[model samples]
Target: MTDIEKKEQYAPYISISRDEWKTLNGALNFSLSDEDISKLNALNEPLNLAEIQEVYFPLSHLLNIHIDFAKKLYEAENGYLNSGRKRSPFIIGIAGSVAAGKSTTARVLQKVLSLWPEKPRVALVTTDGFLYPNKVLEQRSIMNRKGFPESYDTKRLINFLADVKAGKEHLEVPIYSHLEYDIIPNRVQEIHNPDVVIVEGINVLQVNLSEKHQGPQVFVSDFFDYSIYVHANEKNLLEWYISRFKQLQRTAFQNPSSYFHRYATLSEQEAIAIAANIWDLINKPNLIKNILPTRFRANLILEKGSHHFVKGVKLRKV
Candidate 1:
């Protein structure tokens, strides 16, 4: 069955074709140049001004409407409680398989949302920073399962989200280096007060149950005011993963400091083989076992075609 047909089985979501979705782009006066799109595009992913107009433009507008409603809800609750309370940042969680273009979606949203007439302060954070250090993974003997849920510092990530929702200021987030393939030693990213926060990762919408828990459990999605999932078929995802791996081998892997520097010397066929193996052994299993199960949990879903272009959008009915 097709992706849209599969989605039709779920009554909670209203799926719309790309052509239909583009018509919802109301008079909100905004435009992004090709230069801007080039900066926002992820490695090997294609994003153009037309895609932005058809997809992201309406998405951003919808988010702004949600944000406005959220502000009003805060005010109403404060009044009902008869207490002076400050509004907290609206957290947005973006989750999907690796190489599904989620990073590009987050970056584009951050840029587009920041450009709104209100000019709200927008902050972007990836859960990669919350990943357990390579040393920790090695010690646990799960180094090969780097992207698995257990490899993440879930407690720390939950705490960070809690603090951000509590209006904490000058929060420090650990930095993860993709080139080094590990968390940085001491460097950190500081997040100040922002109107919106975009948390992007492979496992943002994931839920883990613990037998040791007594009361209620606090999940990462609990802190998100809105959530999005980027979706593509397994075949397309594998192809994109291998393509990105080959591009990295030509670029980042060539750096002497890169953790995968050995891959830089590999021939084209050898690199393709390695990439396919990694995807099969690591990424594909993770997607089926953990990530794909959480797709329906998202408030919005961006379905992509084989070319890395969004072909349809599914929004959860209120």
Candidate 2:
């Protein structure tokens, strides 16, 4: 590539093509069973051995290297201060548009990171738990604006991260159920003594944690040891979103107790219409305004092509 082309391609980052990324996987020794993929992948998503070998293994190894470097930094800082400090859970924020596969990436990394020689325990948490409950959104007259930044309890979420960073154990975070389509009342998830915490959500990379954020002020991203933003074309995301909606209609939505059960039996055309409307109104707006704007903040980015195959990996320049 010419210098101008190379500069344009990798400005602000060092970009690697899929073929180049694949070669880095040679030293990775790991495999996932079919059952693991079924449990971790999103509805209507496809994840095969080739995808793991070509994309995730190298990615996992890179994260491991980062984690090691962070440990050394922590020790050095403590030494300089002449104080003894406990190692806190390494926090990783995974951000992307809905149906962009951030959840699957977070889960896969959690599993692979656990298997590293360090045997570090990993905990995965979705910021959906930090979303305002349905009643709160309804009262605020933003039920239609659910995925927007204003739809979340930003202060509480920031406090939760603060606690986690302070080395607190057995912290209780609310549980959100996709099946129920809301936060489960009184159902809590405990984060206890994890070596790593993966926080995934549509707004994980929000440049500002709160509306009142001012110059040189603290933001939620301040707590992340590493952040990744998954990227794909807008057309691909819409297709994936609608496709997953159909899959859920056949599965989760069919359950009598599911909040979306009403849409389960709709005809294909009807289902498509509703899904498209939702994308146009809610998901897409939030992506353009809140999520996509934060993409430049991530330490690494995984760019996907058709069928959710990662075609490029960009590591931010130091």
Candidate 3:
């Protein structure tokens, strides 16, 4: 049987093929301009008008319903607490393997959600900000495992989410610079009172951490109102990662101050070889050991086909 025929195999997720999903896009009046699409798409990722019409518009519509429901829930809870309070930001987590297009999904969701009829204020916070500084990683002897769960200051990340979920205003979040590939010391990105916040990272869907002896085990996932996992077939992800590495060589790596500057002068084949090795040795292992294992935890799964087109989406039945 085909995947569609075997939909029952993946319980709790009603599998919807691209064509089936597109059928739900009834007269949704949303179109992003070429410039906007260019800004939102990741390097070597395909995101055009067709994707917005068929995939994202319906996705955004569903989010609008969820956001509205969340608002009402918050109001009821506040009444029970006997404290007059505004609704906290509806936090959404986006996760997937490296180069699986989570960043693009996060950015696109942030933009699309903000444009809804409610015109809510939306914030996008990447967990990259919570990664331990380079010095700290080196001290921990985990520099080679930069993107692993151990590489993050999970406490700080959890604290930030807690604050955001508490409706705290003018909070500070650490800033990460991809060009430098490190956390900038004393630099923070301020989040004001946003109605919705999208938390994007590879590990967002993973369970929270705590010592067994600790009291209550609070996980990062506890703060999420909804979560998305953007995944591609393993083969497609490897190819996309290599393609991104080559593009970075032509672009970002050319900057002398770039963390990957040494790769700028490499021949195309040479760059691909190094990128492939990195994928095989570092990224693939982490994906298998950490990221992919957490996929089932996501409320929504966007499964992409070759060249980054979302071919299917699995929405959790519950």
Cα lDDT of all candidates, in order?
A: 0.93, 0.87, 0.89
How high is each candidate's TM-score? 0.96, 0.94, 0.94
Give the TM-score comparing model 1 with the true structure, all chains together: 0.96
In model 3, state the lDDT of residue 68: 84
Candidate 1 per-residue C-alpha lDDT over 1-318 given as tens digits, one digit per residue, 9 for 90 to 100: 898777677689898999999888776658677788899988999988888889988999899889999999999999999978678999999999999999999999999899998899999999999999999999999999998999999999999999899898768889999999999999999988888999999999999776988998889999999999999999999999999999999999999999999999999999999999999899999999999999999999999998999999999998
lDDT-best of 1 and 2 = 1
Cα shift from native, residue 38, model 1 (Å)? 1.6
- Candidates sorted by TM-score, best first: 1, 2, 3
**Per-model RMSD to reference:** 2.7, 1.9, 2.4
Best by TM-score: 1
Q: Over 4 Å off in model 3, which ranges?
A: 1-10, 80-82, 208-214
Q: Please give the ranking of all candidate structures by lDDT, highest first, separated by commas.
A: 1, 3, 2
lDDT of 3 by residue, 176-196 (tens): 999999999889998888888
Identify the leading candidate in terms of lDDT.
1
What's the distance in Å from true for residue 52, model 2?
Answer: 1.4
